[model samples]
Target: MNITLPGKAATLMASQRERAEKQRARLGVEARSWYRISNAASDDEAEVMIYDEVGGWFGCTADDMIAELRQITAPRMRVRINSPGGSVFEGIAIANALRAHPASVTVQVDAVAASIASVIAMAGDRIEMAPNSMLMIHDASGLCMGNAADMEEMAELLDLISDNIADAYAARAGGTREQWRERMRAETWYLPEDAVENGLADEAVQAPKAGNAPPAPEEDDEPDMARAWDLAAYGYQGPRRDEPKTEEQQPLTINIGAAVGEDFVEQLRALVRQEVKDRTVAPASDATPTGPVAETEPVEPAPEPAAVPEPEVPAAEPVDAWAADIAGLLTTPADDWAADLTHLIGPDTSSRAAAEA
Candidate 1:
């Protein structure tokens, strides 16, 4: 098959292939067995495990999976997957084979079913996810190593593959293909509950507990499984097993006008005015000047200026206009106001003169 891969995926494949080749150089044919099959002898059901990358130079190929699948005469099959997915064409081929099989196939997402592995998931007669498992879907992507024409062709091919994948999702989930396509473009990830809610899985089942299991498997005894895989290579960095799910918090809002009543505002203003008046009436400081103390005697206070005649009062304005004027006057800082009361009152010269004195 013609090989096309995402840049990082291709790099990973190359590294694994090199390691596999080296192992084969020393271990001979034993190193090439990349897939696992169990319970094939049972007539009722058989198990197939796809716990690694899909078709590649070193990993399990579609032909190998199909060849083994054909040998299983069981009427029911269980395909367990915990894969990061591999070649899109290979995944499609495997999905097709499972769909065409005479046995009823049930797919269990043991840990994760991401990328093209999710496509293979659609072939199941019934899909189930463990409570903490996840399934992800995204637009098909691959690297093109040729000229402009070749790049364009590759882009077109990717589009076609995405559409086909979308169809597969829609067929199982009962949504319009365009709706699924939009989600795929955004690279949607689904927890078990979300998968069931979206109709992608029949149900989320409890994880099976092994009888007589060891206290904990040794770290070096098994390869780094699901959680250890670098899913960031495919732009997925979401919740995983044994991690807490954080919920988004709503922003806090305060309504000052509602919290402070008009009566409180009036009381506050009165307090401020009394405070200002006390500060103004206090005697000036008796401390000597910082630069130099003048020896001259203090001059007598100048006689009070002759009282000016009050201006003629204008006719009363509209209530709104009067309110607006009062509001504008209130905006001035209390500290900026002069001690003169006449500027704020109607013809009350006696009170103003008394205040000035």
Candidate 2:
């Protein structure tokens, strides 16, 4: 049945769809099969993948899926879904077919089951969702091309469809039809655990190991393809990929003594000492000249002066014995000065010398 949206909403959706079509065209994206069927672990078991939209836009229609299912003679069928949903009627038909199948049906939500796709999931005897997967429920919506009467009729039809869909949810999850309708109207999204807690899924399960998996199609090789769909156009604002995580860097450590030998360290210290001594001794070398230098006149010879008698030197003040000893020690060679000073003073002098060195 044709679904309907409000005038403004329908117009916006049409514009968005137009833009998406242009973008897909620019990207050279061609329509291809959105599902695959293959044998499972056992000969009597089969797996069906509905990994895109539900209808022909970028996926298979109900007739296509049902026909494929008819060919499987397995006693058990595993239906895996990862879709943003498509034609509501198509999805409902597929779901009904799965329910009518003689095989024990198991539904696995690989990533997402939104809109009509969630209805398709309800047909499973056992529904399992991947840990990071999601399920969404929303009121039926579509476009109608006509005047006020046609719009009104379309709106009424959409409400009926939505009510039926809500009833399907209520049947599975044990809620009142009206309660489910409220949630659908709000576009409820459920994470794996939430889906289980709300009875939408039986359990959240771990994905099968790669070793036990069947070879995937080349188109599905890129994991991001699931997240790459334009779910935004459907007003889905659920989880999505962010930037990839980078490996944490290890902390750095340095062993100075091991990196540079003791000899090298000593040499460095000696160079530092020499630098400090030079800076201390010639601090004025870095000063800027303040003014121009005056010209020097030639020195004139001084006239000889009469000699005067030298006054007798006053008796030298008696020097303290310790002062004499210190004076003598000051004359020692620079290499022995530390030792001499330590001898004159005490252990503290030796410590001071070592520290200065």
| Top-TM-score candidate index | 1
Q: In candidate 1, which residue ranges exceed 4 Å CA deviation?
A: 1-29, 32-34, 40-43, 207-357
TM-scores, all candidates, are 0.52, 0.50
- lDDT of candidates 1 onward, in order: 0.75, 0.76
* lDDT, candidate 2, 1-357, per-residue tens: 234355555575465456555554665645466778886657988999898877645434567678988988899999999989877877888999999999999999999999988999999999999979999999988777888897888778888899999889989999898999999889899999999999999999975676766777697576675566779756898645674544554456564436865444343344334433554574457767788978899889898899998999766445556545644554444646544433433322345347845
Q: What value of lDDT does candidate 1 attain over all alpha carbons?
A: 0.75
**Residue 355 deviation, candidate 2, in Å?**
72
* Tens-digit lDDT string for candidate 1 (17-81): 57656665777666555457786537699998888777755544577678888887888999999
Model 2: CA > 4 A from native: 1-31, 206-357
The candidate maximizing lDDT is 2
